[model samples]
Structure formats: C-alpha cells, structure tokens
Target: MKPGLELGNTAAITAKVTPDMYAQFEGQIVHRAYSTVSMVYHMEWAARQIILPYLEADEEGIGGGVTAKHVSPTAGGDTITATATVTGLKGRAVITAVEVHNGKQLVGTGEVTQYVLPRSEIEKKLASEQAK
Candidate 1:
C-alpha cells in the first residue's frame, strides 16, 4: 500500500441495467430486473476504485466480505449507480459503506470490506488453494 488513503474517500460506478444483469439461477432467468448479485459487484468495484491509486506495485487489494440488502427492483434499460464511501480503516483492512440507486430511488445498500496484502502472499495463497 502507498500513502494518502483516508476515511471518507469516495468512488462511484454508473451502469445501465440489462438482461444480463437480471436475476437468474443456474442460467435460468428468475426475474427481468436488476439482481442483487450485480449490485454487489458494482459496490465492490466502487470500493476498489478508492484503493487503486494508493496500492503499491507489490500490494493488491482483495475482497474480504460484502453485506447487501436489495430494497427495490430496477428494470432493464434503467440506469443505476453504486457509490462507496470509506467508513473505516484498521491495519490492512478497508471498510466502506455502499449504496445503489436508480435515479432518486434507493435500490440497495451494503458494506464492503477489503484487505490489502502483498502480491506474493496472494499468489502463494492461490497456489496453496489449487494444490488442495
């Protein structure tokens, strides 16, 4: 990690809802609206943007956890935005509060937790998992 990451830092991502983002299970579409899974991915991406500028060449940020609640449905072609704000930082952990919206309506909210680790450490962990 490099310098300059702080609390209250923010980032956002805007996307238009599409059929691919619809609720589905095992390749079967369950609903033709935006899915919780897609919302969570956007939330994580927004959080990742906050750390990108601060990471060193040898450091990588990994998803630690995510908690989300889908409050409303958004149909295909509706534009949605996900924003993340840094809420806490402890040691190598970065915690962010995230919100998803379709225009003025709140669609979902969540928390994203990320851990900064050495790139070598991450690669070693991946290798260990593969060997298992």
Candidate 2:
C-alpha cells in the first residue's frame, strides 16, 4: 500500500436520487429528502471503487467505520456527486476522506476507514464459523 496520500485527492462518482431511494417518516407531509444515512451509502460506495483497484482479487477489504456531517439537504430530482480519496494507510487499514456535492453545492463530508485482508483467509474464517 502507498503512503502519504492526502485529503481531497478525489475520485468522482455521481448518482441521481430516485423515488426508490427516499425515506418516509410518520407525520411528515412528504418523505424526507434522501436521508444522510442514504447519502453516506453512496459515499461509501464511491470510496470502495476508489480503493478496490488497489486491492488484490483474493484480498478482503472491509469498511470499518465512517464519520460524516450532513451539511446540506437534497431532494428528489437532484443529482449527487461523491468524491473519495485515500488519505492514509495505518497497518492493515486504509483511511479515506470523502465529500458529496449536489449540483453546485457541497452537501456532506466524511472520513471512512477500511481494513484489508486476504480474501481467501477471510472466507475460510467465515466458513469455519458457519460450520460450528
């Protein structure tokens, strides 16, 4: 793994918010704008694409944690773009900084940590657990 990767070195990813992605809340006149939870989902997906190429096919990569602040609101009919970059690698974990922009506005920012391991080993471990 490479070191010294900085924040804001980004990979661009975009998605259109559709009805299927909205959240419904009781007593709310309309379904809330795509929730921050949903936005974060896209953010992580973008981050994965950015780092997946760096991982070997038989390697295991796990998204361990995320910290995000939802700064702006986006409703349906909007297109959101997420950018993620490798910021640091500590031991087996890779840290990423991510930002999401809706059209011309910055909507959210966050950091995510992922763990890398050999995929074959991870699968073997899972199978062992299942067998027990």
Candidate 3:
C-alpha cells in the first residue's frame, strides 16, 4: 500500500470485441467507430482484478477517480489487452496506472483511484441514516 509497491507489479486482462457490443446511433453510419473496441472495458476489468484480491469478502470497492485517454480505434474481431499497475496507496484507496493495447497499438492509458470498504458496514450505515 505504498507509493512504490505497485511500481513494478503488473497484471494483464484480455477482451474480445463482438458485434453485440457495437453502438448503433440513429441516422448515423454504423462503422468501426460505433464498435465497442473492448479496450475501454478491458482496462477497468484489469484494474478490478488487481485490486480485488487484496480485499476481504465483506469488502466492496468503488471507483473514486479515473483519468484516461483513448488514443486509437479498434474494430470488431480484434482482441484488446489491458494492463494495470499499482502505483500508490492513499489510506484505504489504491492508485493504479492502466494501459490498453490492441495488438501493436496503444489504445488508452490512464490512472484510476479505487476505495475499499466493508459492504455490510456501508449498508448498515445507510440503513441507520434512513431510520433517523
């Protein structure tokens, strides 16, 4: 949970683009631009996998922040890969740097902030507030 703890640690996740994931805008041309490249979702999936293992069963995680830039466009049938590195930890929150790539090109890169909390504790607190 330190700044350098995640520096060299890396995890990779893969996602395949399918026709069902494509977006169809009304009156717009349905092209590769409308396809869900799978890179965007892959990045989030990798981040969660990297952070969730460190949490307890009763704990829940929320994405507090994300700074990402989509660089390239990928088409359907292409497989995207996402990698996440833990860069730092602030209290119960873990800061990570993520990158998504399609074959040889980088599709996206960014940082994510995730918070860890006990699920039961959070629900109980909400219930108490509602009862007040």
State model 1's lDDT. 0.95
For model 2, the run of ten residues with the poorest summed lDDT: 1-10
State the lDDT at 28 in candidate 2. Answer: 47
Output the number of the lDDT-best candidate: 1
Per-candidate TM equals: 0.97, 0.81, 0.77
lDDT tens digits, residue span 1-132, model 1:
788899999999999998999999999999999999999999999999999999999999999999999999999999999999999999999999999999969999999999999999999999999999
User: Candidate 3 lDDT (Cα, whole model)?
Assistant: 0.72
**Cα displacement (Å) at residue 58, model 2:** 1.3
By TM-score, the best candidate is 1
Over 68-120, each residue of candidate 3 has an lDDT whose tens digit, in order, gives: 78887777778878899888877878778998888979888988777877887
**Candidate lDDT (C-alpha), each:** 0.95, 0.79, 0.72
Q: lDDT order of candidates, best first?
A: 1, 2, 3
Clashing pairs in 3: 6-86
lDDT tens string, model 2, 56-126? 66676877899999898888889999888888877887788899998879999998888888887778878
Worst 10 residues of 3 by lDDT: 32-41
Candidates 1 and 3 compared: the better one by TM-score is 1
Give the Å error, residue 125, model 2: 4.2
